[model samples]
Target chain A: MALKPYIVNTGIITAIGNNTQQCKDALLSGKNNIGKPTHLKTHWESEIPVAEIKLSNKALADMAGVNEEWPRTALLSAVAVKEAWLPYAEIATGLRTGFFSANTVGGMDLTEGVYREFKETGTVSNISSVINHECGAITELVAKHFKIEDFVTTISTACSSSANSIMMAAQMIEAGMLDIAIAGGADSLSKFTLNGFNTLMILDRQSCQPFDNNRRGLNLGEGAGYVVLMNDKAMAQCNATAICTVSGYANANDAYHQTASSPDGIGNKLAMTQAISKAGIQPSDISYINLHGTGTANNDSSEGKAIEGVFSGNVPMASSTKSFTGHTLGASGGVEAVFSAIAIRDGVVFPNMRWETQMEDVNWKPVTELQTGIAIDHVLSNSFGFGGNCSSLVFSKS
Target chain B: MDIYIKGTGIISAAGDNSEGTFLHEPPTYDTDKLLSKEPNYTAYIQPMQLRRMSKAVRMGIGASRMAMQQAGVEKPDAMSLGTAMGCLQDTEHFLAKMVTQEEQMLTPTSFIQSTHNTVGGQIALLAGCYGHNLTYVHRGHSFEHAMINAQLYLNDHPTHNILVGGIDELTDSSLQVMKATGVYRKANSTEQILNTNEPGSLAGEGATFFVVDKNPSEGSLHIKGIGISTPEDTAAAAAQLDKFMQQQGLSNTDIDLVMSGWNGNSSGKEFYDNINERFSASSIAGFKHLSGEYATASAFGLGMTMEIVKHGAVPAHMLLNGKQPKALKNILLINSYGHYLSIWHITA
Candidate 1:
């Protein structure tokens, strides 16, 4: 049986902008949002650069229409989910709408702050409510806010959380289990994540440089992105235009170390191969590749090697959009999925912002400049996270 | 659609691995306190690898290896794992180091093992099974997410086997936090879990794995369907169960056994009471009394249901009612955790 293609109607909220149009304009104008961290205070603020969203917790809570005391993670997620569902709210009213969200750190920002207060004063008044910082709390918040009652789930495979969320949503829709799915991921900047990465020596002190020979490590970013996936029946009822069709997607585990990809990129190869096979397309059919280049030494090299092994000389015009938007962890997959859809819709190739040099291990260079008016029929986006959770999704123009 | 459970394994406070877990009687633990027994990590995992692994990953890999061995397969087509609070031990470790050590001489081990997918990825690497791998961490419905994904994989690729499991570990701090929040019962409570009027239940953790395929193996159990919902409406949940059972072309009478996630609390018991009344003729079993109440306790319930179907008898202790069906054809396992409700159907 032929699988039905799910279309993407994305809602994006990033440090770059609020909506799709503003994000696109920011991307084209080369406006970067890397600056000092104000919403979050950290000891490493003097040394590190982050892509922090300027919105305050109260402002985000107001936008989400939740109470003033809602968890920061909930507020951020509500903003993204509200934007994604506004256009399709009525169609989802009577139908079975499921939500799948991924977050690496659930309410760490709130917990860390409260923990600090407790340590200082030995009182627990401030952070008692945010104690439910586990993976499910934020997901329940979204499900409640959207009034989605069926099949709400959360996936947290580290950085691949959102990618896996999107993949699972597609599988559920294909299995005739759901009619529409709001699938994506969100994560906020927290001292726990920052110090965790910093302790691992993976936090680049300056701006992150992906696909570069001297790329040190990744600079963490925080945001949320979601896409509304409507099945054929739901799409017909709403008369919605598909930005692109999710033709193929596959997830493979590297079985390597906890944080590093395999040197051979076997897992990466398997994911891409399976995705292409599922899409029923040839390797040459892919025109754009959104590499999960996290600016880390291990990721860029292994990902590049994997791409070379698969495509060889015919590598697609690829770039690490993470260079523009710092690795958003769980939200990277959703954010990049939206970007891939934009590439297909606008027929343009976004640049790899700081790719002045390519690694010596692979014979490939990212599309360094924004190339407009290109015939991009298929876009393959890759998201690999800790625990070797590797996933690839192939999006094609409708 | 036609997914068969070829092999299954479990390691929890109840027992070590599959053989030990199934043969021994489930252990009784306090309902309102933390329950965990230290397993000898050296027997299942290498010291070097186990040095930095959190309890969740350690138990998860052990269970996965046991399942693979039972299935007698080198690699599965896909791997899926579910967890609520993923790698909390390592997460807590990293957080403490960051604050105390000032992030100076931090090793990458804890940080690396802190992610939720560490167990699934490690299992893949250990078994050399580089297939579709995913980890779901949706509080109570974590295992359901994995089971649903595994079902979809079986539906898509009928020829392949998928390894799915759910794992959670209780950390002292986390347990303390839950206790502080009034989610756990008082330590001295002596009332039976099913009859208890307490407000909270005990906290425990474990790992359970299943090798699901379209082809039936030597003692295969068939997974029929799964359904999940939140705590917004208990009546709605009961209605959803009715519809789900109807969709499977089965009535409440066809259900021979029901395994419930009754965790010795007033609300939890009430939820099970509603389910039990619906299947009044079927023998009911409770698990959290043995495994304790964790987010992924449903996986333990699934393991217990598999044992009941395989052994053709309800282990004397698990039965709520003395009645046992002559032939076990259908088993409905229901679990509600962290404001979410899930139901799974399995048959032999």
Candidate 2:
């Protein structure tokens, strides 16, 4: 609580952009990365919409400078991690380096292919293909790629997974555990997850309209995001310029249901309120909020009520970047955290994309257009997920 | 900061070690694959809810319940868990259906239960605990990270009682995959596993949970240090162990017992020989012969060591070198899974 972890740099890739600057550029122009995706090969690709990055495994591997045989999830993670590690790599040798990554599906894209073939013919041809099938295996693959062996771990608490990862890295830093931590998460679109979300019947055929009264459901997206965190020692050694200081973060469980939030967003409220308290600030001190508005009926409604419960008056400029990138699932927290960092760095408010009607539960209206040139000191980022996992992070201007 | 292990619960090939129940003689698996000696789910979970859970979730719930009951903790301040491979049954179910049905007319039950954090979520939901919760899945380091997180929580909130555990389950599909990789073999006998000069080890799975209290009124069990290392070569494992010992201000002679992961296989023989050379004076032992080999089997080793400290006797079958130490004090556990090594120092 006393030591503020510094976020020195960030990197991200989504349907709208491939890097942090590119994402900022896309947000300013109000680009919609959601629609019928071209990369994902699914039976519902024609009927259901997604936000897949327009690239093949071969292309992503080439860009990542790794083996093409790796999982798409690992490839995405390597690309963003490489970008995040570039500046930090200078002084990483003198410090204890760590890599904490997150993902939901692991190497399911590869596992399903091999498993399907085995199921069809009852013969196995290369068991090595699915060797990275575990979530941690994917983390190790990318960790090995970066040669970050001082410390390594993976978190998988669903959509809130990477927020918790970022939070964990900061805690480790505050506890004087590691000097440098490259933390975030990655997930690539796969038939396994596509059908899983489809089975839940939460896919919106059209581009998602988050925080809108007529919002049906979410459009699943795929990508990776990462942030380099450093304590004072590493910062001094690296001569790093702080992008932002992590003021506070907290993780809480909804405990209401496995797949759904408590109708009032109890976990969301606790996470936000606790983080604000830990940051030693008032609710009104927040400049903007990057909502976890996944365009789902339950998520937006629950998250909105929780926001109202915490704040007394008019809320600050807030929007859901998911409207532009769609719901990136496991990668959303890191993806949105990068968005939040730049939002404070440049004082920009990304749009909520399309909001025709407001939900009756809350009075605040999401920003409908990109607004820049405003001073932002504090930004709140939300990431809620299945399995009752909910987390929030607060970053203050350094 | 010193933390005490107030209570422990485990459901593994060893036994259902709940309150009023503890493993005295570990059950020997006649088959190569070792499954947990599961308790009646009705004792910990409702019948209706039990049907919905996969075996991993059920074992997690049952073990956590046993730990909470023994510690008298209705709700903990936080929970952190480790599972190398999570919810395999549900993951495979969802994958098989998606592949066979071509993503049509599937129910959400398996998909909903397939999440890695389902056990933690279910436990938190049942306990009505709204505190810090986390899950680690970094192969061998998974359980160690969970332990590290628990220590961090206690460092911040010294009065807090945290629940921490490691869990992994084996499914037929997963076993098939492991078999194809040539590290899995069927059993001849539990005794034969320890002496095997073969290429593979027995497959096993289990759950182990502990109630870690920063301010326990009475306890002897303590965690001195936990460290993880990725050795570039076979010889680097011992070098990392020496560095960790120096970090903890300890010497090889200070350790009275060494519980090493000597899973019976040619691939693991070098590591076993390394452990033997490092701790020649200490009472050397292995648990994979009793608990079998898994990513988080070190959790089982920790639980077994706790039982030995409480009872003040090491089971004859547990000691590989066949020499029981006259006194038990500092016990070290080193587990190797894949390319990772988890080293833990438990003090009694």
Candidate 3:
């Protein structure tokens, strides 16, 4: 038998809820608590909306049991990973453990603030404030908290980062290098990313309308998500139930534009087709798809076209959960992966909220209502990013 | 499957070896900063396109192109790059504008180019490659982790050509920040970095790329293994290396050379000394003095070791303890940042 990366556990902290069960309840009840932010200190707070977790940094630290002085990205990552590792705690005693994380912003939330003060004063009392500025430092913070030292690294491929992190963990497990891996990503709302997206004209002022022809752009959200992947040997050594198997994954580049998707969705098509092919299944075998719908015109059109290409018009039940959580950037992959796992485990699919119209480019409509009593044997998840970094992952019920 | 390096390219303080222009700049032998000596990027990228690129992207593109040309591969099956603090120049650019402009009227150019994977993405764009792309951002093991991924890719697809590398750029603001954080030296350290009394290591930066595959080509260099050890682990770094060596069907005595990443801090002198004693038969060489120090400096160390493999002898200045090994076949590269270590087993 081929080596498989079985997902043993998952954890998440999004706007809809703080834990997996809470988020599941929200998804089941069709609740999208995305609105104006009450915490993020942005001048456009009232003008542009976001899907922010209603917790202060101190509160998040209290949840993570770490210092509040750490970067918000790290804080978010530690909380999610801690939850993910809770069940598998010391079961990994004899296993080679790894932590593969992802994040785009690093510590810019704190760095930007410290930098402004440093520029104005030419001096600051503390310089360690910016010490966690590197993406690796975020991983380090969480790794130290958990004592996972066999391997540690962060992938920063924009939005598809956490997806790639999960993929690498699977690959390493298959390569017989690691026995277990906690893979995912985290990103906190910051002036840097918010303003950057604003300049790109991709930040929707109101709630996002994914897969709708009249869609403008995406609403930026903040949170973290993680999954515990274990090989068969590690599974034999541990006492945990398998949630799902990381069946297949592919990371393909657009090679078209730095931050825009190709009109033909060549890279998107490759990602979807290759992932399905790697899973050794036909396109129709997939029961549901978690779309990478960022509500942007380019993303929806290109992604829809790619879906059409992959399924040949017989589209599977698919929906973009971004309407519920907004576009979480680096954290989107992990957050959605957790959803995919839960979907397969519980036999359900969440709805894409505010998906009012069909995109003219493709002939399909996303699932708009909560679904139950369905066989979600295989779930495909997509995560694409700027610089044309595109990735898709397939999860199957274990 | 034996992972082999088909071609190598680098843009660094030492210069671009594939372009046959090394030591063009005044050597940064006695300085606290060792910046890469970039080639004329017009040869690889358009002048207009090059104008919009940051220092990191330019070097990444330049080095990857040279590597592709040398390997006779126009499009690779995948690109895996490791950058510790990726695209720092553009990151600082966007951060500066956001702070000074009060978060309004920010241009998207710098922000667009500020992503950690921009260099890898740009390389894909130039090659029109729609293959696997990844960027690892660990502190010291960044490049090693990339190589590990490439090895796994080669293990799965033996015929696939993969472009793998690491990059880090030393921007002015980044250097200033490092100095303030005491990660960089406040004053001039010893030119002889190995014997230095300095408190902090120098900050250096560069980009190095390699086209690797399962099958060997002309003058191919083989990678026996690449593994990393974290300080938080209960096992010692020596145990990690010994276990890796055992997996590769070798022992400490089989290693002909040990290229150590001694970061010029006397606090680590005892550690390197212990390493020197363990590999008693191997020649100990230091490269931080030549390449300075950075997260991916080990990649530069690998680059220099590849050069030695091509020339069939280690440089005299690099050798710290023993004379150049006669056979230069088995080599071990131990890169350390703090107590984190990455061991690369190489063969000619």
Best by lDDT: 3
Identify the superior model by TM-score, candidate 1 or candidate 3: 3
lDDT of 1 by residue, A151-213 (tens): 788888888889888888888787777888888898888888887787678888888888898
Residue B80 of model 2, lDDT score:
96
Number of the top-ranking candidate, with DockQ as the measure: 2
Per-residue error at B210 for model 2, in Å? 0.7
Please give the clash total of every predicted structure, in order.
1, 1, 1
**Pairs clashing within candidate 1:** B31-B202
DockQ of candidate 2 compared with the true complex? 0.82
- lDDT tens digits, residue span A57-121, model 2: 89989888998899889999988998899876756677988888999889988888788787776
Off by over 4 Å in 3: B21-30, B187-190, B232-235
Single out the weakest 10-residue window by summed lDDT for candidate 2 chain B: B19-28
Q: Which ten contiguous residues of candidate 1 chain A have the minimum total lDDT? A: A114-123
Could you give the interface RMSD of candidate 2 in angstroms?
1.0
Error of 2 at A380 (Å): 0.6
Docking class of 3: high
- lDDT per residue (tens digit) for residues B229-283 in model 1: 6755667777777777887888888888888787767765556778778778888
> What is the TM-score, restricted to chain A, for candidate 3?
0.98
lDDT, candidate 3, A163-209, per-residue tens: 99999999988878789999999999998999999999998989999
* Candidates 1 and 2 compared by lDDT, better number: 2
lDDT for B44 (candidate 2): 85
